[model samples]
Target: MTDQSDKLFTARLADLVSLCERDGTYEFSSFLDERQCADAEQWCKTNTGSLRYRLWGGYENARRRMLAVYPDYCEEYVEGDYPFVCLTFTYRREDKLTHRDFLGTFMGMQLRREVIGDIVVGEGIAQAFVTEVAAKLITTTVSKIGRVGVKITDSKAFELEDAQKFMDISGTVASLRLDCTVGLAAHLSREKAAVLIRSEKVDVNHHTVSSVSHELKEGDVLSVRGCGRFILSGINGSTKKGRIHINLRKYI
Candidate 1:
């Protein structure tokens, strides 16, 4: 079932690319979740050259992004000029709005999920990236999110900084199993890590891997639901106890 889904997704993306090639025009896809983005990137590796595609979500650090495919001649197009519009939502200074809050509110608006990209929560404000049409619709229709009244406006001038947070960690694992690597990166017991994997709370490269014994390799990204996200940097060497020494960069 998973392979079929992946093939379908690849086909859909290829269709979009074909459209761009046929018309000699830039083509943009709807917002893709993390898994979809990873899949699309993998597809690009063997199928299309990097210059033919780009990804953007109105910011340098975005979990969800849209794929833009165009002819090789259109390489000069700036990513910022993509069809995404940033909407800034402001509420009372004392009111606390989280990423989840903003996302839930937008989802409540009954808009298509693909039309929404990323929602970034900042101090007393939150920014959302959506299709141009969704931005215009949201400004007029969205007035409140739960009890907090919100004022929405275009944030075209808002400057996004590179604010991705990560911490480097080093540890030794008995093996390269998913549970072992997750335990080391999250500082949890092996039993707990196995439980998380069994309960479907672990993802590798954005795809859920429920097997605790799944082997992990270098450059793999692991996301534990409650723990956090981490990248398997590399296996340095083996410890005296035969455990593998590894490095991980955990995203805060």
Candidate 2:
């Protein structure tokens, strides 16, 4: 059932992309706002499988665009406003990027407003609606303030607790890395890291990594699919390229 839905969404997305490329009838260049969503929804209801329209952008910009397209839709959104909304604005950098690239770039894009959680990667690359994108963006944004895992060599259990408290960890483990720095840091055994790898909990280069010994290189994205992602800065110790050091930011 999931597979069928995925395929359907992909097919629909392809059709939309084709429409954008062929006739520009959907006005891909224009920002889609709340009003646009309402208008689009009405049109979709009547047209059935007609290009599924959605708006994506930062909140205010998206709102403005939507209002311009469908003022009444904005009223509905305003009346029942939730803290989160799914909408994205297409930018010049995103114009030629693929869905995967879009996700990675979105993860790295700057947010000028306060969104309280790390953005989850959009579940469906093909049929990604504004909400899904917003969710991911929010999750990623939250990660900045989140805690990352670090191992301090020779640190006692009590010290570890102190470290965790110092970090102010909450529910989820926001980031993970094999800390090679020489200071009071949390450390994960190769065995534990391997378990994460075997469980399909780790991703490198935007793909799931199953090998625990997957050598951490400089500038690699150590993304633990569902867990979080960290940018691996170069090893900071004694070596030609320095020690194997990883830099992590919490994925919200």
Candidate 3:
């Protein structure tokens, strides 16, 4: 099923590239999940011409991003002009919400995951990016998330902010193995780290990899469920005991 999805995704991207070349105009794709976005980027590098594309999710920094493909002539297009809608969800102050709550509400609508982009949870409010077509459905049907009444509206003047906060930590690992790196960044024992990886609770570059021995390199982003996310910023050098010195930035 995954392979089939990748093939269809690649074909769709190729079609979009062809459309841009043929019409010499801008073409946008439906909101893509993290895996699809990565595939699209790789496809663009080897298959298309100097076709410029922009990845955005109605925010300055987004996790799930969509692609906007255009010719050089369309360089003047702004990020806000992308074919997406930002919906602001407001609930009662007494109802404390979370990212999971907003996402659960959205999923309850039975909308495809591809139709939604990044979801930012704020104090007493949340912002969601969905395909322009899905915006109406969400605003009309999404009234509650587990008893919390939500009022949804189009956020025309919404300002995007950095959705994540980070703290820097430096440590030395015995090796660049996935478990070792995770143990260092998350401050866990080697046994606990291996359990996390083996349980499919870890992701590298947003894709789940269950191999405890998966090699990690610089710039790799690790997302550990319940432990937050981290970026392997650098491998400074080797320690005297043959361990690897590394710098990690943990998202708070």
Better of 2 and 3 by lDDT: 3
Report the C-alpha lDDT of model 1 over 26-132, residue by residue, as the tens digit.
88889999889988888877776544887877766688899988877787874756888888888887998777787787788888889999877666677788899
Off by over 4 Å in 2: 1-6, 25-186, 213-217, 225-228, 240-243
Better of 2 and 3 by TM-score: 3
Ranking by lDDT: 1, 3, 2
Quote the lDDT for 202 in model 1. 94
Candidate 1 — which residues are off by over 4 angstroms? 1-4, 49-51, 158-171, 198-200, 210-219, 233-252
Better of 1 and 2 by TM-score: 1
Question: Model 2, range 130-172, lDDT digits (tens) per residue?
Answer: 3334556544453221122211111111111111111211111
Model 3, span 1-252: residue lDDT tens: 288887888889889899999999888888877767777788888887798987777666677888888888787974757878889888877788878887877787788888888887766777888888889888777788778888888945555465556799998999999999999877899889999999999999878889999999999999999998899999998988999999999977
Q: What TM-score, over all chains together, does every model reach? A: 0.82, 0.34, 0.82
Q: Flag regions of model 3 displaced more than 4 Å.
A: 163-170, 186-202, 207-215, 224-228, 234-242
Candidate 3 lDDT score at position 217: 94
Candidate 1 worst ten-residue window by lDDT: 155-164
lDDT of each: 0.84, 0.37, 0.84
